[model samples]
Target: MQRIEFRKVIDLSHIISPDIPLWPGDPPVTFDEVASPEKDGYYLRRFAMGEHSATHMNAPNSFHPNAIGIDAYEPASLVRPAVVIDLRIQARDNPDYVIGIQDIEKWEQAHGRIDQGSVVLFYTGWQTLWDDPRRFINADDKGPHFPGIGAATTTFLLEQRRIAGVGIDTHGADPGQDTVYATNSQILANEGIVLECLTNLDQLPAKGTTLVIGVLRLKKGSGSPVSVMAFVP
Candidate 1:
């Protein structure tokens, strides 16, 4: 007989709860102890929240009028090879920077080509400020400033790179200062999936890994909160 040993578990899910915080306008997630042994016969907890809070997925229906719901999304699509492209330097210098083709090119120059049908994650190191509302939102007299993909960059990935989806360590895949929501619109229109509010990307390697994302099966759901994990092999 042979004994088996597992390496390490890389938790990709962001902590969730009413106190986890959310995008300024989105409803806060809430949980209540509906049943307790001291108060009731058993112990149980009821939960309530918006589907789009915390680490979550954006279904095609999010922006398209006649697109498939979150429930219809194929399970195979949720699990795929993943790579992290570090953009902390760019994000630190330009809070409102939109990840572009040049960034992708630079990443490829360092870490081989991005494979087709792979999940491309942008690591901006923004999750460090998750506890501070001011820093998390980067709200100023002008407005919230954050890093994300631009319209052109997203279109390029969808059309040229043919990636499975895009993930980001930010509230949304689009920059907070975006007036038109260009990136989101493009992705949804192109039937592209998006994983948002991701954390702990810094803990994973740059390449040679797979990601497992479990999204709630909400009928006709535009999106749903997900438990994401990364496995290095």
Candidate 2:
């Protein structure tokens, strides 16, 4: 038997606060101070936010009727081999960039085939602009602008590769400007899982890592905030 060892753990989730930019029209987050150690014996806080706020996971139910919710998947299915696809340069030049088939092909060529049940993360370096909501959303009269996976690439991963999940360090897996959400629908139709608003992906290697995703087991919830960690040996 091969012994598995975790040499390092890296956080891939963004800290959620009032400053965290949410999807337009989504409810704002609230953190209430219920008690303090100095006065109420122990510190306590009550908080609430949109289920999709911060680093979060989206189940197929987000789009497909009768599809599984965030709690339906077994814990084992959520832990899988992870591969990071770096496209920071392209995203730097064009914030509206969309990861295409060529990007996947090139990554596979340099590394190896993306094995089935693998978790693939797109590193567009968008986390760098997280400090400012305006820049992060990149919204204006023309709507928001940010790099994301295109419909074709998303379809290939879900249909062809049969990946366990996909993730990105943006508002969502699809471009903010894609009001129609065609790509998102395709993924959901294929029963795909998505982790959005990830951060610190640049710290991971191309492959040979395991992603430990922490998702709230909300009952019949479409999605929920998640905390993702990478175990690298």
Candidate 3:
């Protein structure tokens, strides 16, 4: 058995609440009191939210009609080495910026080639806007605009590195303006998972961290909110 050791843990998930920015028309998050300590000797709440709410993972079925769901993932698939690519400066310069081969090559020059089966994450500095839904979504008549992976980058990661998944601190894996979900579809087509709306990415190193994702295994679920934590060595 492979032993796991870490000196610190960084929460890579956002606190799920009613106000986090969501896709344009997804169901709103709701929390209702199911029982109160005074009345039932227990405090419990029932919450409802879209599968891809807050910090969430996307199953292949999210974009593919006949693909497997999140529950199909095995325990080993949920724990893997993770690498964070810092693109905050570039994303801030252009919200529509698409991570491309040039970007990946540059990152590799500095960090090294991305390892196979690693979950690659992008820190676009978007998490800073989580408090303001409008700004976070950054939508207008033209549609949302945010830095994200595109078809080319997604394909490179899959074909070259054989990445297990891709993640970002934005609401969508594809750039917000991409209604077609180009990146999502490509990644999902190969049975790769997608993580979004992640937080605390600023606390992570460029590489050498293990991601232990906690996802709700809803049967045939297209996706689910997740509690992603990073094990820092």
Per-candidate TM equals 0.92, 0.94, 0.98
- Model 1 per-residue lDDT tens digits across residues 107-208: 899999889988899999888877775688887777788999988998888888888888998887999888787777777776667898888999888887
Between 2 and 3, whose TM-score is larger? 3
In model 2, the clashing pairs are none
User: lDDT per residue, candidate 2, 1-233, as tens digits?
Assistant: 63446899999998989889787778899999999999989999999999888889887888888988888878877778899999999999999998999999999999988999898899999988888877888888888899888888988888788887788999989887777776778866766668888999989999988987878999888898988889987
Q: Which scores greater on lDDT, model 1 or model 2?
A: 2
**Candidate 1 residue runs with Cα over 4 Å from true position:** 1-6
**Model 1, residue 52: what's the lDDT?**
83
1 or 3, greater by lDDT: 3
TM-score for candidate 1, please give it: 0.92
| Residue 98 C-alpha lDDT in model 1 | 82
lDDT of each: 0.84, 0.86, 0.92
